[model samples]
Target: MQGHTPTPVFSVRDKRNLLFIILGLVPAAALAFWLHILPVFQGLYLSLFRWSGLSPKRKFVGLANFRALANDSLVWKALGHDVYMVVFRLTAVIVLALLFAGILHFSSRRKQKIVQGLFFFPNVLSVAVVGIIFTFIYNPSIGALNAILTNLGLENLTQAWLGNPKTAFPAVLFPTVWGAVGYQMLLLFAGMSSIPKAYTEVALLEGATRIQEFFQVTLPLLRNVVKTCVSLVVINTLNRTFIFIRVMTKGGPNDATEVLGNYMFYQGFENFKFGYATSIAVINFTLALVLTFVVTRLLKKENLEYA
Candidate 1:
């Protein structure tokens, strides 16, 4: 009988606390929706119409813009450039970063910190700044690269790096790798540091050489970290538009180095075709998302038990 007393449902204090929590979050939620979500929706809507962005008129064309993009040769070419970026820039960044991280990880503590700091310095600068610096470095007449080649008697190798279509994409790719390597190095270094010293020590005791230990122990354990780094690099390489377009070549020499980002920018801003640009943006976003998901899933299958 005493246990039969019913507990009160819906306590007044609990309800008041819930109400206060909702009220407190309302402003932040509103701001996010207005600034981010609303704009995304607006962009999607705009993609369904034909608009010049500045004109006073907009004509609804349904999926025609997307269809047009599918047939646009330039879009495919830009996408190919994006693929090249992933292959060259992203791959170089990951390789150099991991190599540097490995070297720093095996060094003394003091040396490790110094090397880490030096490697990560490039990441501190804005992308635009990095582009500008590299632009000067690749300048045909006075750039450091050309200057070095000239001094080394490799004059035949020296040309207007950014001006020639043959070298323009690779020229931009080098700077992208230089700017990005530092950040990825730091991430890999942190991951490597988290690995227990006992594993390597045991490997050494078993008469395993340092190279053998790296492949047998360190790399296997760092698989997850490698996956994360790869995903990030891919996304960055795909989404990056401004730095390449702004610094070296703006899809110059007959759209040779044009990537999706630059293509979208040209369509929307330069050509004033808002609808077409929105379609490109949507496609680019979709590509990035798909690549991220696919790579993450593939890596997850080979995930190592770091713990």
Candidate 2:
């Protein structure tokens, strides 16, 4: 008799487990596509029309909104403010966070936890709350900052922090840096902690000073984390809203503090120019995408392993 053909082994349990995971993920994937991705595409489509947000009629404008944005001086000004935020506010936050992370990495575990919590405390509060708090802190007449300045005999240096055009942008940016530095610090600290202790110990044995070890070894290994922190801060600064501008200035003192996000809001909700607002949204999204891609690509080219 011919040898019986061997039956292939099939594991029902493995098949069932795989099917269950796929089934569980389907709803989440669908929800994400519907809620986040669809609105972006819809905004892109709507940007080619001229329609107030509540208008029943929509005229096919064919890039008129984009053309208008190109010619609008206010748009340029708002873009400048956004760039300032990235350059000034975001840079300060990242640098401060890195410094704090380095200090914490060298501390005892208990002290490290306490310091980390203190740094991150601001991030736990809602943006609105932080905005309100800072608003009071910067109040021209009664704010804590000005009060302290007056008591310290620096009355000449004190001015309407959030009301004056000269100080408004920096005043608004201060709280943003305060609120975000902790999150970035934690990320950097985690990255620094993961570096092999043997490397540092060897360097110390060779009589390398703390500053020398930091510059030669710690900074290089922390490069990937630094890149990530910079990217996060840049994106956050670009998209910041509902905090500094909302509570402290409201893009006031003649729009001195207006960033792209607030500009888009004013166009859509305040001005009722839905199509134009959508166009602005598209531009902001495009800018963010381009910046993120360029930064990530440059980091990768430098052989910084983010993971």
Candidate 3:
């Protein structure tokens, strides 16, 4: 047999293009490493030790924190709340956003602009402001919700929305959905708009009903956008629930509204269990990664392009 030289894996032009693409991504990659990737690794390292956040004394008790997490009842409770929040918030927000987006897509331009502005206005407000507003609305006495109920002769239907243990978790979710719906709606609307009109026209011409057209045509084409929205919601549900829990309920009524983020903060900052807190953080990050992967996989499909 004669010896042969190996062929290049990439052509010269392909190599050049790869280099340019990498150079273009350098800033983003650097930023993501610094802000996201580095912190995750740091957290993993810290989870294996015992230390208060500020103390000089550090002890390596490998896997001890994770063991503690396994036995902690609060961890399971908070995780349950997180699951509930993710399921309900994801469903409500996506459904409402899609509904409004469909309506907006079909409306006149003037009506579309007005409805979009109204829907998206809540996103302009800070989370703290929205939480506070909801808190006042849910107050046991003199809350807008109660007042409305009383005026409508439904006084018996009124109760402390954020105060009662039974209602606190669900109550916290409403504001989150309210604030999120507009942004998601706009995203879906843009997806809808980018779809060529010819597709809808063809569907209609083929005797497809509007509902059938939406299910078979519009939604299938919007898969990528919907996937992005789903991924965003999952990440936010894991990471961003802290502010809502802190401001709205503070995981109150005997930790009834507790989520992983809230409990992690309580452990690290309030109780100074940095190692244990980081363990919770590790769990959170893992769950987020897994959920994102699931969403991406579920929504994976061939890209549809308009001619």
Task: Give the number of the best model, judged by TM-score.
Answer: 1
Tens-place lDDT per residue, model 3, 191-237, is: 99999999998999999998899989999889889998988998998
Kindly list the per-residue Cα lDDT of model 1 for residues 1-307, writing each as its tens digit: 3555434453335677668768888999999999979999898889898999898999999999999998999999988787777778656988898899888888999998888788788778888888888889988878999999989999899988888889888887887787788889989899889999999889989999998988899988988889889988988887774456656688886787888888888898899999999989888888888877877787676666746
Using lDDT as the measure, which candidate wins? 3
Give the better candidate number (1 or 3) by lDDT. 3
lDDT ranking of the models: 3, 1, 2
The candidate with the higher lDDT, 1 or 2, is 1
Worst 10-residue stretch by lDDT in candidate 1? 3-12
Q: What is the TM-score of each predicted model, taking all chains together?
A: 0.90, 0.89, 0.87
Q: Candidate 1 regions off by >4 Å?
A: 1-23
Off by over 4 Å in 3: 1-37, 301-307
Better-scoring candidate (TM-score), 1 or 3: 1
The ten-residue window of minimal lDDT in model 2 covers 4-13
For model 2, the stretches where C-alpha displacement exceeds 4 angstroms are 1-26, 241-243, 293-301, 304-307
Query: Model 1, residue 119: displacement in angstroms?
Result: 1.1
Q: Which pairs of residues collide in model 2?
A: none
Pitting candidate 1 against candidate 2, the one with the higher TM-score is 1
Q: What digit string (tens of lDDT, one per residue) describes model 2 on residues 139-208?
A: 9878999999999999998988888999988888888888999999999989898888888778888999
The pairs that clash in candidate 3 are: none
TM-score, candidate 1, is 0.90
Instruction: Report, for every candidate in turn, its global Cα lDDT versus the true structure.
Output: 0.84, 0.82, 0.89
